[model samples]
Target: MDFNGIKGTYDVIFSLGKNCLVADQLSRHMLRKIGGVLDWVESPALPGVSHLLRNQFMNFMEFPNLAITGINEHAGCYIVRDAAYHIFSHHDFPLPENTPTQLLSYPELREKITRRVPRFLDTLRSSNRILFIRTEGTIHETAELLEVLNMQVAGEFNLLVINHAPVSGIVETPWPFPNVCALQIPLVPDEFHDNDYLWKTLLEGFHVRY
Candidate 1:
């Protein structure tokens, strides 16, 4: 099932009184604006469908005058988050024996993943679209990297730098990119640390007016 379906399922399962009510209302509102499940299902299968849906829903409910773009942005703007470690680490920790050897810290694993980074960057640069980078580990030099990559991509295309890091490491730097904007989110602990409070805070942070 899709993200909306999954969220609806959770609302039904938890039945968190007013919270559930709000979610149901928002879900129904979104469905109405987007022309029901048929329209949503027909939407292009893109990586950032959830973001697109949220943006659309916000425009419909909160800012009716806003001329929100559709799924075309998926092709026109490529948001590339750091997946070098994630893509490689998925093979280990909880997967069955059929996992690939590269995930096992086999010889030259780091080099193998590092080698692909340039190719991925090249592909993004070649595209006639804005490339938004969410630098994962290397937070300190993100602004510099964003400018450098933006130059390589299209100087005219907008470049957005989203610092998803919990800390203010690299974002403190003074490097400026014309098209870059920083979106910072506070760090929340994992389930083991403080699951309920963390999740509740996150939900509150993302609450919609609808």
Candidate 2:
């Protein structure tokens, strides 16, 4: 797990930023893989030991809803308003829940709420919380998305972005924003190469859209 030279506790979520349809196994499976990469860094478990804690993300569509074929003691739904989404640790927050019903693409959702993006930055300017954001894209793309979530959360926050290795196209370092930093990871770790492949496969899926 590359720390990216960061140290501290921050408010963040496990999100692809690119939401895919649930029924679509490929998409859902991809998210699980992506989340595995994130968890590998966020809270890597010891060899042969389980993690002390974990979280679940809910995906909501035009009309969000969730069905359970199993039992979960600690569960919560993700909340969305005006196409903006946020996931909580539990249902006490009463977020939107669904049972993998309709397709929910974050790229498409971001397009519909493009005009509202600037507001997220404004919210960041006024708060005091830290945000650990996960991205399956480039640094700049991740930065832009983080700004939106940063603005939506009406509290003080910092941004910790987990992302892919740097691209040759972008040359600047130290990030444009002092409040933001990123850890270079991959969309999918090479199974044969990544030593943690076995543990990674154990990761579950979280459909929280940023």
Candidate 3:
């Protein structure tokens, strides 16, 4: 399928975070126009799709302290005031493994998953089209995630994968499924934290209509 050939509105626009930057910006842009899946629901460490696939109870432990690094303005892709430890990922504040059972006791985290997961799944299952953005996952990981969707979701949907790559323009589809179309924009990995304007400009191309 051709990238530009994708027609009609999307069911949802979502990303697995290579970091929070792209998801945050994309979600906000979509919200102002068409509305979309909440981007803050993912993490910054580039957790694989398997992490999300296998775990329902996202659990977390309080970090000992927050640390700041000067590498970029966004400060390591995720930021929560004074609670900046990698352990304290925001919104979806749960670690995937070895979590103490008590951490799941937090009503906040449990309620978030309970409320959001069903809506997320329903939106995907019901929509005729979806736009999935990729920044972190490798080719294989992307395929695995899509495969899960194929099995669980009833009825077929056109998938447009907007891959943020180092080189610009159209790139080969990582998974050659007939309903899937892939496009690449010139965005080096982790660059969005420092150079948000680039991501902004790319998204700006999706003009809002009256």
Candidate 4:
């Protein structure tokens, strides 16, 4: 997990959640060492663990319908408006069990995550250096995210993509921003979030004494 050293400190660490747990933990680690200077704001962009096979995240982001579709109760996930993926912990339903399906597409659905989208975009625009973490996703998924960001946010930035998925090795990309590092770390399913070696290498690269 040795990382090629780039330049200086990052402005923000934007995470595309397979779940927010990894991001939250990373923020804590940074907080203890670097204090609150680094931003790790929770936004509705990939709010929860998106099951890649069933509800493909690339499809969701690329083709945004703004339509509320059917729910997969077994996965405890529901797709809200603006393509937000929400997975309920402990299999709890957000609404009542027998709530009308049409009621799901009401104005209330749009209001919840709509405000945060612009805020996230604003954050992206303001920051010049970014450490984007795809906690558990593939290269194609990461590529889709880069495409969306390139369209919405202006200017180039130093991007480091630490993708903690079951990828074989370092994969190549066609994006112009040169400092991108797509890590080839295999995801340990049972011990999903804990990766001491990975973080140690990253923190060291950032010049953080861990």
Best by lDDT: 3
Query: In model 4, what lDDT does residue 23 have?
Result: 55
**Superposition TM-score, candidate 2 onto the true structure:** 0.34
lDDT of 2: 0.33
Q: Residue-wise lDDT of candidate 4 within 1-210, one digit each (tens)? A: 124545346665555544444455566457223222112212233323333212333333222444344554644444333344432221112445324344433344334335444555566677555555555444555556655656544555444555545654444333344545555554556433456555555545452233
Clash count for candidate 3 is: 0
Q: Rank the candidates by lDDT, best first.
A: 3, 4, 2, 1
Q: Write the per-residue lDDT of candidate 1 for residues 1-210, one digit (tens) a residue.
A: 111211211101111111122223334333211112112112122222223222322222111221222222323321111121111122112223223221233233234434433543444445443323232223344444444544454323442222334652223322344444444333445312323332243223222111
**Ten contiguous residues minimizing lDDT sum, candidate 2:** 47-56
Runs with alpha carbons beyond 4 Å of true place in candidate 4 = 31-112, 137-141, 163-177, 205-210
lDDT scores of the candidates, listed in order: 0.28, 0.33, 0.49, 0.44
Poorly placed runs, candidate 3 (over 4 Å): 31-38, 41-47, 54-88, 91-105, 160-165, 168-175, 187-190, 193-210
TM-score of each: 0.31, 0.34, 0.58, 0.52
Off by over 4 Å in 1: 1-88, 92-95, 98-122, 135-140, 164-175, 190-210
Q: Kindly list the per-residue Cα lDDT of model 2 for residues 152-189, writing each as its tens digit.
A: 45675454444445342211235666666654443345
Whole-model alpha-carbon lDDT for candidate 1:
0.28
> Which scores greater on TM-score, model 1 or model 2?
2
Candidate 4 residue pairs that clash:
none
Ranked by TM-score from best down, the candidates are 3, 4, 2, 1
